[model samples]
Target chain A: MTAATASAARADDPLAIDVHGLVKSFDGKVVVDDFSLAIPEGKIFGFLGPNGSGKTTTLRMLCGLLTPDSGEGTCLGLDLRDEAPLIKRQTGYMTQKFSLYEDLTIKENLDFVARLYEMDRRTERVEESLKHLGLYARRDQQTGTLSGGWKQRLALAACTLHEPRLLLLDEPTAGVDPNARREFWDEIHALAETGITVLVSTHYMDEAERCHEIVYLAYGKLLAKGTIANIIDNTALYTWRANGKNADRLASKLRGCDGVEMAVAFGADLHVSGTDEAALEAAIAPYRHEEGIEWFRHKPTLEDVFIHLTAGSKDNFS
Target chain B: MKRPFSITRLSAMLLKEFNHMRRDRTTMGMMVVIPLMQLILFGFAINTDPKALPTAIYSADTSEYTRDFTAALVNTGYFHIVKETRSQEHLDEMLTRGQVQFAIFIPENFTRRLIKGERPQILVEADATDPVATGSAISALNAIKPRVMTRDLKGITMANPPAPPAFDVVVHRRYNPENITQYNIVPGLMGVVLTMTLVMITGLAVTRERERGTMENLLAMPVRPMEVMLGKILPYVLVGYIQATIILMAAAFLFRVPVEGSLTMLSGATILFMIANLGVGFTFSTVAQNQLQAVQMTFFFFLPSVLLSGFMFPFRGMPVWAQAIGEILPLTHFLRIARGILLKGSHFADIQADLLALVAFVIVSTGIAMARYRQTLD
Candidate 1:
C-alpha cells in the first residue's frame, strides 16, 4: 500500500508498524529515501533489496536503533522519534551481522540479553531458549566456536528472549545452509502465529514467499509492497521459457533487447521477461521455430519480479 | 626469480603504509602533538630549581632593620612573601595546610638583641615533604645573613666591618627531616599508577565493543547511556583498588614509605580518584570511533597528566599558566591528597579542597561523557 493509505489499513488489523515519509542519510548521501510501510500484527512481512539498497538502514530505523533524518512514524503504537526507548523495549531487532559477543558462551549471551530487558525468571527463560535453539547440550561453548548457522540461531534466540511483540530481522539467515535456513523460517512463522509481528529483510526468494506480505526497495526508494501474488501481478510482466541446447547462452544476447527486461538462466532453461507482452512475443518470434529449440509461455515467478524491480531503479551511491 | 627487494614493490608497500597512517588522523595528530607537548612542558613548565616559593613572615619588631631583612629575603629571588602573619600560630597553620612552603618566625626583641650583641636566633621552618622544593630555598637563606642589615648594623660593634653574623638563622625542616626522595616518589607513584592504568583500561571499554560489532547489539537493547557507562566503568573501579592496594603494600613494605594518616580516608580518596579517571576514560571512549583511537586519546590526556600534574616536577616551580593547567587535572589534586596524607598525616580538613576537586572532576567528566554519549546510532 502507498504511504498515504498505510494509515487507512482496516481497523480490525492493528498495524505493528505505520511509518510515512521516512528519510535517512549518511555523509550527505541519502541511504533511505522517503520510504513508508505498514505491517499488521501477526503477519510476517518480508523486506527485499540488493546490496546497499537501504534495507538494513530502514530496519534500523523501524526498531529505533537509528533515528530518521526526517520522518514521522510509530512502531508498536509508540512514536518512533519521541518514544524510541519505549519502542525499543517492545521491539526485538536482529542485526544483519553477528553482533552477539563471541567470547561469551551461548547461555551467557542469552542471559545478558535477558538481563538487559529486566526479564523475570531469567534462568528458566535462558534454559528454554537454549533448548529451543537446539544448543542445550553445548550452551556453555563459546559462540565464536559455533558455525555460521548456529551463530545465527543463537542471535535470534537472544533477541527474542524478552518475548517482544514485534521482531525486525535484517538478513537473519543470510549465510546459513538450506536446512538451517528453512528451520529458521519455520521458527519465524511459529513466532508470527503467536501474534508477534515480524518485519524481516532477506535476498532469498524462497524466504520472501514465506512472508504474508513483501516490500521491495531499490536505491533507498520503495518500489513495490504487497502480498507475493500481488507484487508479481502488479508488475504485469510477461515471460517465456526456452528449453533447448545452449538455452542458457541466449541470456547474454537477449539482455539488452527492447522487450526483454531480464534474461536470466534458471538452470537448463532461460527465462526472459518484460512488461510489454506484444513486444516480448515479437522479440522471441525468431527463436520460436529454431532447430532443436522449444519455447513455451511461462508464468512470471517472484524472482522475475524482484530482478525486474531492482533492474529498473537507480543506485543512490553511484 | 626476484631480487632481494624490488624498488617498485618496496615503494608500493611504503605507499600503502603511509596511506594507512594518513587515514588514521588521531594517530597522526597524536604523533605530532606528543613531542610538541613534551617540548613545551620541559622547556617552559618544568623547573628543577624552584624560585619564589610561597613563604610567610611573622615578626614582633617593626623596626627598619626588620623591614630591611625581609626586603633582603625577597631580593634573594627564592622567597616570595605571600602572607605576613601577626602570630606564630598563623604561620604554623599556613605551613600545615601547605599554603606556604616556608615560614620565617622572628623572635621577640630581635632588634634589641642585635644592638646588645646577643646574636639572637630567628627560626625558619621549611615544609620538607618535597625536599627538592625546599633544598635550594634553604641555601638561599644562608646568603641572606651576609648582605642583610649591613647599613642598619652600622655603628654597632657587631657590624664593625661585618664582625661575625648579627644573628643566627636556625633552619627547621619539618615532615621529612632527612630529605629522603623515596618518601616523595613512593607516595606520588600511587596516583601515577592509578591514573595510567585506569584511564587506559577503561578508555578501551566502549570502543572495543564498537570495534567487535557488539556495540550495535548493546545499543539496540533497552539499556541507557548511563547504564552502559557505569556498567563498563564500575568494574574497573575494583581493578583500580587492587592496583592501589598493591602500590600501597609496596610503599609500606618494600620502600618503607610511611602512611601517617587514616588508611580508611586514603582508601576513600583513592576510590574517588579512580572514578574521576574512569569517567575521563569513558568520555574518551564515547568520542573515539575505534579501540586504537581510544588508546591514542588516552595518551593525549595521559601525557599531560604525567608532565603537568607535578608528579615528576615541583608544582610551584612552573609558571602560573602551567600550574593553572595542572590545577585542572585530577592527577594534580590527587598527588596533593596522596602526598598530604602520607607525609603530613593530614586530616580531612587539610586535604578537603583536593577531595572536593576530585569529586568535581568525577561529576564534570561523567556529565560530559553522558552528554556526548550517543543513545542512538545517529
Candidate 2:
C-alpha cells in the first residue's frame, strides 16, 4: 500500500490510510473479500459500487467499525485490530440518514455533541459551528423541522466538532438538492485542504469525477482503482462512435459480435467499445464501408468503461 | 470556539432541554402525569388483606351442647365452617392440606360433663403459617366463645348442680400482626413505582441520540462509552430521585401510612434500587429499536414484577410453584425488605437476606446492561 501510494499520489499531503488484504464475512458469505487500498491524505477519495456490492461493509472495516475476518493493516499508523477506539476517536462518520434529534434545536444538537467530546469553551465552539455551517440564523430552529440542506450542514458540523483527522462520509449529500450538494462538497474539499482526509461513497457520475482518485468494487472485490485517465487506460478499452445515417442499424448488427463487449445507441450515435483492438477492427471492417455511416475512435469516458466492465462481470450473489 | 465539551456545553444542552420540554406537551405530561397516575393506581390497588377464611368443625358425638358450640363458631364471621365431619382423619387432612384456616372438636362426654357441673373441654386447632391471618381469627374466637362459656357457667349454678364445663378458644393470624394489610402492601408499592418510571424514562435516553443521529456525532468524537453512560444517566438519576420523593410523600400523606421506621434508611435503600432499575432501563435502550419498543419492553417487565411480587396475595396463599417463580423477581425481595423495615422495624439481621438478594439483582442486571450497552456504541 505504501508503494502504491508513493508511486501514484503526488498530492501536497501523502497517504493517511493504508490497508492490505482486508477481509470480512457474515453467515458464511464473504462481504468484503481480500480488499486493499491506499487513500491519500488531504484529498477526497471516492468509492463507487453497485448496491450490495459490500461498499458500506468495506468502508466499515476501513474505519474500524467492523473487524475484517483475517487481515493485517494500519490506519493512522495504528494497528487496525487493537486501536479501533483510538481510530474511532480521531475519525468522523456521517451515516446515510438524517440522524440528529428532531426534537432538539440546531444549536442544542451541536452543543450536545460538543459536550460528549468534553470540548473546552463549548459555547464558543457551538457558535462557530453554527456560523461556519451558515446556520447561525436558524440556530434556534428545531433540527427536525430544518430542510435537507440545513440538516446536512448540522450533521456535518456535529461530526467535525472535535476536529477529527479523517471523515468517513457515507452518501453525505444523498438527498440534498443539487445546489446544497455542491455547497456541501465545497465544504468537504475545504476540510481536505486543512489536512482532514475524506473518504466518500457515491454513485453520481459527476461526483465520481470530482474525486482525486476513484476505487471501483464489484461483488466484494476491488475491480478497478486509479485516476480517471489511468483507470480507462488500465481497462485497455477502445471506444468508437458511429453517428451519420445507419447508426441505429449498425448498433443492431454490432450486438453479440466477437470482440465487441458492449454496443449501444445514444440518440443519433452508436457507441461501440471492446478490449481486443485487432478483433474489434476486424468485426467493424465491413461496417466502415457501409454508406452514410461515419466512424471515429474516441477516448473512453469513465461511464463507458464502467458499463463495459459491469456488462462482462458475473453476479457473485447468484 | 469551544472544545467538544465544557460546563457551558452541558448547560447549553440543559437549557435547550428545558425549552423543548416547554414546547413539547407530551413529554411534559409524561414527566408530570405518569408519576401521579402510577402513584394512585399502585398505592390503592395493591393489598394483602385475606377475606372469608374457612374453618372445619369436627364433633365426636351428636349432642345439644356440641350443636350450640358449632353455632357460636358460625356467628364469629372471621371463620365459616366448610364441612362438618365425624372422623379425625378428615380434620387432619383439612388442616395439613390448607383446606381450612381452623378446626374445632368436642369430646363425646362434653354434654355429660356439663350436666354434672364439671369441666367440659373443647379443642380448637389453628394453622400458624401466616401469623396475621391466624392472629385475627384467634382474636374473634377468643372474644365470642368466652362469653358463651360464662353464660353456661351461670346456668349450671342456677339449675344444673355446681358449675358448667370450662371452654377455651385460641385465635391466630399468619405472616402479619393483627391482620394489618399495610405490612405487606407498602413494600410492594416501592418496587412497582421504581419499575414503572425509572425503566421507562431512561429507556428513551440513548434511542433519542440514535434517532437524532447525534450518536454518530458522539461516536465520531473522543468520548468513551463510560463517559457517555455517566453523562446520560446522571440527569435521569435526579429524575428518579424526584419520582421517588413524590411517591414517598404521597404514600405518607394520602394513605395515612406512617414510616414507622427511619426515613433515611428508606431513601438510601431506594437510591440503590433506582441505580439498579436505571441500569436496566439503559439496557432496554440498547435492546429496543426505537422509543415505542422501549416502552413496550418496560410494561412487559412491569406486569410480572407486580403479579409475582406477592403484593396482592399472601406469599403463603400461593402455590409453591408460584412462590418459586415469585422469588426470582426483584419486587419480591423489595417488598419483603420494605415490609420488614417499615412495619416490623426489622434490623439488618432480620432483613439481611432480602438486602443481599436485591444487591445480587443489581449486580447481575447492571453487568449485563453495561456489557450490551458498550457494544451498541462500539
Candidate 3:
C-alpha cells in the first residue's frame, strides 16, 4: 500500500501497527511466516512465544529493523517498505540483549542516542531522561558496571528519549528482577497513557496478562491473538486443580493418562488440563475418591493454554 | 583412584578444540594461509640489490663518445635509461619528482675534451634517498671506465687502454651524501606505524560494535551508513595524528633524521594517508564478522604493505607484479611520499601523484566500507 492509503487507513482505524501476510526467512528457514497483526494506538500488546518462535523477528519487521520477505504493512501510519526510514524515525526499538555501549558512561550513552536522533534540545532531553529514570546520581558511572536491572532501565530511557510514537521492545525485561520488571511495566503503561503504542515480546505469563492483548506464536506461526479472557475462552481447556498430600507427586502418573493433555505441578498443587472435559473427568475419576486428596474443577490459566498450544505445534527447527 | 592425566579426558579436550577449529573456517584458513602467503611474498618478492634503476640521460653533445658512455652504463644492467633530455632542468625535474633515480649529464665538450686528451668531468647525480637502491649501481660506475675506453678507442688506443679515457667521473650522491639507511627507513617507519595501528584501530571499531551487540541497536536507530562510517573513522584520524606526531618527533630528535620538506606539506599528506588507512580498516571491519577476524584482516593487509611497500626492501627491486600489488596499498604510495618529502625535500608537485593515489585510496575504501556496512539485521 502507498503511504497515502496507509495514512487513510490509519485515519479510519487508529491502528499504530497494522501488518498482514508478513513472511521473513533467514538462510532458507522461515522465521516469521505469513503473520498478521493489528494493534490499535495506545494499546499495550504482548508477544508470547517459545524461544526462536519468531517473536523477535516479527517485532523487528514491524519497526523496520528488518525487512519481511513478502509482506505489506504500515507502522505508525507509514508504509513498512518504502517509508521505513520515516517509520524508524518515529519508532523506538529495544533489543533483547543489552545493546548500549558498555564502555561509555550512562550519560554519554544517552547523549549519543540523543545526537543520533538529532533531537532539538539534546542536553535538556538527556538530562530529563536521566532524572526520569532515576539515573542522574549514577550518570557518570560506566554502563558495564551497572547491574542488569539498571542497564535495562538505561536502555529503555535511551530508546524512548526521542519520544517515538511507537515502541517495539524485544524481551526488555528478560533477566531483570521482579521489582524492576514491575517498575518497567509501569513506565510502559505510563508511556501508553500518553498515546505511545508498545509491542513487547515476553515469556512471562504475568507480563502477558498485563497487556491489553496478547499474541502467542509457535514455530513462526501465530497460534492465538486476543485479550487474556478471550484467549482463555477460545482454548476451551478443562483444568482440574488437585490440592492434598502427595498431590504434586501425582503429576507424572496423570501426564500420560487418556485425554490428559498436560499435568503440571504448581507449588504444592497439581494442575491437570485437557481439551476434552468428559475424557479428562473420566481419566481423573479413579483419583477422585483417593484418600487425603481434594479435586476441584478450575479455570484454565493462560500458561496452560499456551503450553497446550505450543506442544501441538510442530518444531520447525527439526 | 583417578589419574591426573587421563588419556580419555585429554583426547576429549583435543577433539573439542579440533571441532571448534573446524567450525571457524576463516581462522583455520588464516592459520595456514597467512604463514604461507608471507613466506612466498617476502621470500620471492624481496631483493636488496635492486637493479634496473630508472635513469635519465641529459647529454647536450649526443656524440659518439656520449653514446658509448650511455651504452656502457646500460650494459651494466644496473641503470635503465628511461628518458633522454637535452635540458638540464628537465633532468633535475625528473630526479626531483622521483621519475628517475639517476641523472647522467655529459657536457657538450665531452667528445672534444676526450680527443684533445684533456681530463673532462662527466657528472652523474644519483638520487640517493634510498641508499641501498643506489649502492650497487654507483659501484658499477667505476667498472664502466675501463670497458668504455677499451671499446670506443680501439684503433688509437695504447696497451694502457687510453689512460682511463682522460676523464674524471664525478659521482654526486644527492639528498643523502653519506648514504644513511636511517634517513630512508625512519621516515618510512612513520607510514608503516600509521598503517599498522590506524588500520587495526578502525578495523576493530565496527566489528567491536557488532560483537558487543551494540551494532543492532545502532542500526535500529535513524542513523545513516555514511554517518556510521564517518563517525567511526574520524576519531581514529586524530589517533593517527597522535601516532604520526610521536613517530615524527622520534625520527627528528632521537634518530636525527632530517625533515627536509615543508612540515605543513608533511602534515597534510600524513592526514590524507591516515584517513586512507582508517578507511581500509573500516572496510575490513565491515567484511569481518568479529573483532578477531577484523584483526586478522588488518594483518592480511598489513603484511604485504610492510613487505611490498618498500619499507623493508627496495621498491624497484621487486618484480613488476609485486609492484603492481603494492601500488594498490596506501602504504606503498605513502612510503614514497614520506621518504620523498622527509629525505629528498620533494615539492608538492614532486609527490603529487602519490598524494593523489592516497586520496583515491581514502575515497574508494570509504565507499566500499559504506557499501558493505549493513543497515538492517539481515
Output the number of the TM-score-best candidate. 2
Instruction: Give per-model TM-scores.
Output: 0.75, 0.77, 0.75
- The recovered share of true contacts, given per candidate in order, is 0.54, 0.43, 0.57
User: Which digits, one per residue and each the tens of the lDDT, describe model 1 over residues B230-296?
Assistant: 6667666766786777667767876677889988999999999999999999899888998899889
Report the TM-score measured on chain A for model 2: 0.90
lDDT, candidate 2, A117-142, per-residue tens: 66779899999888888889988888
Please list the residue runs of candidate 3 whose C-alpha ends up more than 4 Å from where it truly belongs after superposition.
Answer: A1-13, A315-318, B1-174
Chain B structural similarity (TM-score) per candidate: 0.58, 0.64, 0.57
Clashing pairs in 3: none
lDDT (0 to 1) per candidate: 0.81, 0.74, 0.82
DockQ of each: 0.21, 0.33, 0.22
lDDT by residue (tens digit), candidate 2, B148-216: 756755666566554433655544555554555554554556667777777887788767767666565
Model 3: per-residue Cα lDDT over B149-223, one tens digit each: 566766564543446545556665677775555566667777877787778877776787899998888888776
Each prediction's RMSD over C-alphas, in Å, is 15.2, 6.9, 15.7
Docking class of 2: acceptable
